[model samples]
Target chain A: MSNKVLPLLMMPEGKEGKVSRINADRGLLRRLIEMGFTENVSVKIIRSVKGSLIVGVNGCRYILSKDIAMKIMVTFW
Target chain B: MTNNSIRVALAGNPNVGKTTIFNALTGAKQHVGNWPGVTVEKKTGSKKYNGYEIQFVDLPGTYSLTAYSIDEVIARDYIVEEKPDVVVHIVDATNLERNLYLTTQLMELGARIVIALNMSDLAENRGDKIDTKKMEKFLEIPVVKTVATKGIGIDQLLDTVIKEAKKGPHHEHMIGYGDDIEEKINQMENILEGDITLSKKYPSRWLSVKLLEGDDEALKKIEGSPVLDQVKNILSTINKEEYEAVMADKRYEAIDVIVPQVASRHDEKMTASDMIDRVFTHKYFGIPIFFALMWAAFELTFTFSVPFMDILDSAFAWLAGALADNVKPDWFGSLLGDGIVGGVGFVLVFIPPIFILFLLLAILEDSGYLARAAFIMDRLMTKIGLHGRSFVPMLMGFGCNVPAIMATRTIEDKNDRLTTILVNPFMSCGARLPVYVLFAGAFFGRQAGTVIFSIYVLGIVAAILTAKLLRSTLLKGDPAPFIMELPPYRVPTAKAATIHMWQRGSMYLKKAGTVILLGAIMIWTLATFPWGVEYGSEDSYAGKLGKVLEPLVAPLGFDWRIAVALLFGFVAKEIVIGALGVLYGLGEDAEEANISDSVEADPKIFALNSLGLMVFTLLYMPCIATVGIIKKETGSWKWMLFAIAYGIILAWTAAFLIFQVGSGLGYD
Candidate 1:
């Protein structure tokens, strides 16, 4: 079934998402992928604070602001 | 390149304990300098193991070897161009999946790799088992378990490096890019081979793959190639972004296959680091906790450093007096007592504070609180249009601006880094602290701590306003995107903290010996000249020159002597105290007279003027060392000049307000 896909920032805390699309320029896109944000990688939103996110992807946690989080589109189950 | 001397390059992602491993292997035997034509620090150290002298080159930590950032370009360039005998890819064992991404790129670079499964103990402690043997077998590389902080597996790591060097350069288990991308890579490899020099310098397949993926640095490598026209045709036909995506996917696919077989976490419970982060980054308490910790850090740094500084001052005073008694000429006695010993002593006193500050910074950093601090503080930073990465460097600026400016290299954007550098000196470095400590102690008495704390607060306020002003004007642009890895917090060990502290703190010592020494002598010569004139009297060159500059600073309540002291302070802020000591006639009374007492005894000085002086010194041009580094890092005299001019203008205006307003309010 086709599930809802939303910006990573909009995902509920504790929900895991499959990173479907990354809306960033070339440099940032490459950085995203390098950090294991490639397509279909499972990204877990561990916490949301102050319009930023604490995300766990591939066993590593990263803190990112809403600006970057918004650029990342992820699929919810 | 020497017989029985192996050259090994250390590569890894940031926060992977790579530096700890390097420090363990090298152990104070390292030298840090910039990579040629780039400001990124290149650290090299040699260690003797197994009758082989192995030289280790510590590369900038990078997640990938792409040309998106200067760090990546520098790391990749060194690996491909230098062609080291062996490359030690230090993988954080607990985060193997995230780290092995770099491994795939290293493999593509065609370097003989030995994996240092670093922090294996941490992984095991977390209930994650990393099978080194299985990891090695699958990746076709030797994997050594290392807990670098404890000095574990260091010899094994060196042995593995030696063994790998002897076996020669070979990259096995290259990721297959599937049919479509592999065809493009093969096509470019054929084209690249025509340029023998290019093919010889870079792995043809790697270069070809990079070119197909639209790597900027890789594209520049084929600038004047014979196959340029044909390569352009092929690049035009391919979707570079898609190729980039697919190739990256393939690399991850390759890693996904191996990491699972080798390592798996047994427990799904929230990690201790996670629990700490939850508390540390909590909505209401996060910011207050951050401020409290910072307050504690500064409190501990200043409290512990003061007594050590006093003891050092007396020790130097005794040495200067002993040397003066033995020296030949009367002027020479003054030189030994006041010029050399006094100047170096003043500068050296700042070192305890610098060391203590960096020690605290290291504890914060190694515990991973710095990254969280950056995270928690990012919104406030971004409000001023400063990047999140700017927070670390600015915090470091409180220790010393020279290394703090150097720390701005992490800001991937050039303009943002430049902005960080320009506003950094306003952070009131350790060298500036001595000035405030002296003035505030003499003026505010029991309230001296509050006064000193206020100066720091004012400097931070100045920095924020300057950054806000900058982002709207000359550096006009959005701040770089804010995303940072928040590494797991670990209990900081004393040894690791000390190593981290000395890594940057020693810059203070070097300045004390070199730049500040020369400055001290220059100030001495200026004050001593015009024969028969009293040392630092009105008839001397320093006094005459200070008189010429007096009008400019008169509005801020500074006299000629204070003017001259500030002029010398431009060499390094620590010299402000030394210059004042000489001008106060403490030159002759080395052991008997105290500089702070001299200030307290002055007829023209009091609390308001002292506060004004502190404000002025806080915002003035960066020290000579910091100026040189700013120029080097920005690679622009234009920006350096702008920073110098902006600081002076800002200093004068701010101090003018403090002086005029404090007097207006009848504070004095």
Candidate 2:
């Protein structure tokens, strides 16, 4: 485990990280938060295809586009 | 307001089996409609529980009651406006922490809620010990463990609803935002109280919270208020976006503390669902597998419906023959035979295909593979500037465009939905297939299959380029964010899937029947008029109309008859071949084989002309029924006319290019 923060797109597949911050337009940001991407919550990259990834958070799997995955800042440990 | 009846609303995140429970409770007596002015579905039913008549409503499946999307706005508005006596919040016990987040928002809205702990069986199977007593005690809401798929605990749920309705709602579990935001919320609430009409309409505290979160609808409600300036002054100091984050964080934080106390879990382990997803959404094989499955669905839909369609075709043909033979007046017989029977028969022929297609889609949706399908195809769809949700509607355009346009409501972004709607007609709906088969089989002979396939590919290209053009020009913006929830897979139950299929499939019949039936009669009337002249002859009204447009189509090497048939294509694309048959003085409902020979025999029609006509048909405007749906869904006549105009212009340009290029190459 190490204290390194990077975009969720950069998180290696099959590893867990904590969501550090989500930078997006107001509507998308609220949606992201409602989907359980709040600060300090654990998120796992379950799979990646091309640039988009399947994120595992709060006992659910969400397929996020590359643009959205880039906006989410995750802290890997 | 009545003591003898209780109104209960069902609310939940998508894929919590909320619909399964809804179907279980409502049975076949459900009324399906759209929320006023929007396309989101609103369904209501009634059941008798404990000597009280209980009315139930199924709200759109959404994670929160925020105004970010239409579904969220509709759900929250229904709660705030209609004020159902009890809202049954269906929660997946396996993911109580996240599901409970919605529960907290429901608390804020100040509605009476009964928590149905759905899928509790799955949670127990995965080695989670859930203490329902503690959960009920903490949330102050009754908890009923329901396995919606198996129809378990439904009576208990209904019984709890009645009891809760009788006792009245308690919003006792209000979340405490930390001091700074709480003080601001209080200040806003005090200012909001100054507006009597507005405060009486919605909860002041809820309004304050929404205003502080930068909700557009909430901000609109405060317009022209005496305290508007004061509220704006308070809002001006803080970034509402940051406050939104903190408020949502507080809601989840409250759930976090309660979840730990109410449910303890063993370390998370890989489940069968994860294993299946690993294979289904795998990068290398995922796209190929999706195409394979989509091919299978299309094959099953078309092939299985053929026998039933043949039966309807023969049945209608016999009925028309009998009607003509038995009737006394000659003209009256034609009306019954050609107008009434033929008109209704056209609509019925599409029923089998529509029903079967909807059934397969519903089963896929219920099995949770639709989201995975969208996931694998997202990258390709993005290249065209459309959201992944747009793919379902685009693929459905092959079956028919009327229902396909209706399916665009799934897209949350206005620009994306409108763009998808505008381009859908070019996908070459099933109604247009007979036209392609007629043209290709007449001109290309042994290469007919290749030519027909090329026309379909051309349609795909047209749809792609049209969507790209619209995004870059009129509806310019990025595609909607492709954030989707992938629920754990379940073997869809037959009862639930059938109910789902019937609900969606039946709506298509109702919508298409009106325009097709009326348009059929109109085309029949046009061809039948000017009684002294030969029916549909050059001296007849139909021929006069064709003559009126012949010059417009002359550059494409088409005469009056071809122009008239093209004119009739707007009624429904399938009628184009039949219309041509009549223009050639054959049976109005002539068989495709007979029509193919006649079209080829006409000396004016050449291979190049036939090829160009096929391209024109492929790119033309949607059927009249689809045009109506476009207006209804987009809620404007301007967009509908835009869709019609752009389609014709593009069709003309493409056909002109093909004609000029093919001629210069000296193939024709």
Candidate 3:
């Protein structure tokens, strides 16, 4: 079963895999959507330092707070 | 062709990469400086394209030409007074509807307009298509699609510009208001038309509309004119303070008509931008994300730059030793090796980390994320009595306090601007990076990165707290209402980001070479005074000065040497490291020399002294450049003195408390 929400920070360590198919929660999720991160869009984790991660989603890289990353659930494909 | 040298004005909303297009149009041929009578920057450049010597004037970006803000006033004044042959209104394609709002206002300015649709790639990727032919036909001007940074469709843009400029300014095809407003505008225009000076310069209808809107500058223009009393009587009869509201309503009415016809909606699903904005600005997650992102940036600055810094440190150390060995003992040797190279090298070693930090900030800014960061912080900023707009300038302060202080022009209120300028020094500018890196490296090991990160956080906290205290007392006023435009996210170009990083990084180097060099020389003199007993010793001039000041700083756990360094740091904080290097008798090149063995052999000797020194450095007075900028910007010496006095007192008190408490807890 695919997770309901994929924490953006915990996406696999490498850049080759598909992002988990999960809905972002409200507020932050809405903000993310407004900034062009939508459902089914593939994202790649570019760099992870300590707990925080910088992810490439829809051709732009976004720095994700580590705490926000924990709530996002993803399915590895 | 000489007579055909068409003057073109490039006008646009902020952050649409209009500057990028300006750079592309006139490579290596641009002059940038402050606009006269105000601090708003004026950038002019020239390019010869298609037999036309296109002199492009980049107007300050504005949302509308309503004359409510300085930028609007400047933009409107240039369009009316300078009378450019063609005005290129660059609009971000992805956010077409909101961008077109400005284009609608531009239509009323009586200048020939051409719309440059920027960021076409983002629009195409999202499957939201713009019918440029339809847009052009509706707006009655030429439309050019451009991705400015990549040089896409630039030749076509220039071709259209030349064609449009050749036709000269448009006499017809102007956007109009409602019949009632148009009638009032005509009446006002008829009365004002006799003034040849105003008639020749400004559009009669535009002036009339501005009069209706209560434009202060426009009012001042006709204030003492013979028609002033008649205009006032007419205004009072209309039962309005000014024509501003009427004009604004008409413009919005025109926008209401134009936007819907030109802009179209696609699939009803959430746009990628909207989805991402949710999480980034979520109430619970927003502040945490901001802090986390900031922490990550600091971590990268402190950690990633270490290897490069080590390389630079070793290279400088090698250069110093080689010069010492090859050159015979003389004044030239000491001056070149110690004064110029050593002093400058101490400052230069910080370039890598600061460069990286700037690179990240440039990316964040270009990606359109910084606006969201500001949006997230607006509520908190209001509570602290600072407008949300103050955050961007303060964030820029982290790179260099000069431009950041200058950026306070964006804040409309005088008090808010002054308050922001006053607290800007507490943001721990790039000049203080060397101080943190030096001591953080010496005492904290790998954890030094975290320690440095906390110092930045502490600086921001202090700034916010200080802003609160000042607002409630000296500059008491309501924070300006938060209103900001969050530009659409785009793939930030590597070239643009690199140029930004270089521009800022080179500025840091320039400051080091000039101000920091003079500061270092002054510090060296102070350290070497009473010429033979050794520099930085208790008998030396700097030491004696510090000794005289020590009693005041005693509570702050600072000795004479630390006090002296703090004093010199007021000239430039980067000089504190050079001052300490000289005082410790650890040659300028000793940053690379591992003094670990000497310190480890005598644990009681304590590198914690250096830690105390770092704390003091972190919290000291604004640097010389910052002080000068504050004086110029605030136009008052009293605030400048207040900044220095309060900063020094706060730094001493914080350092003293940290040292006393830490020592009392036996950590030292």
- State how far residue B629 of model 3 sits from its true place (Å): 3.7
TM-score of each: 0.94, 0.85, 0.81
lDDT of 2 by residue, B483-562 (tens): 88888999999999899778766754664466555655666677688786655567778778988998877777677878
Worst 10 residues of 1 chain B by lDDT: B587-596
Q: Using TM-score, give the best candidate's number.
A: 1
**Top-lDDT candidate index:** 1
Q: B1-668 in candidate 3: lDDT tens per residue?
A: 23879888999877788988987888767777777988777889899876678899999987667655788889988988888999999988866644666776677678898889988876787777778887888778788999897989789989988888878666543557678767877888888887777777777777787777666788887866777777776676674433444444454455456655765654333456656866886757888998888888878888888888777766655665455445766434544555555566766877888899889888888888887766666667777887566888988888888889988887767888889999999888888888888778767887887888888888889889999999999999986433345566667788778877877777778777788778767766776667675545678787889889989777666667667767777787877765554455334444435222222233332455566666667667888889999999999999999998898788778877777888888876
Better of 1 and 3 by lDDT: 1
Residue range B88-126, candidate 1, lDDT tens digits: 999988787779999998998999998998888878887
Over the stretch A1-77, how does candidate 2's per-residue lDDT look in tens digits?
55999999999988888988888987787778778888887888888877768888877888888889999999987
On a 0 to 100 scale, what is the lDDT of residue B22 in model 1? 90
Best prediction by DockQ: 2
First chain TM-score, candidate 3: 0.69
lDDT of each: 0.82, 0.79, 0.72
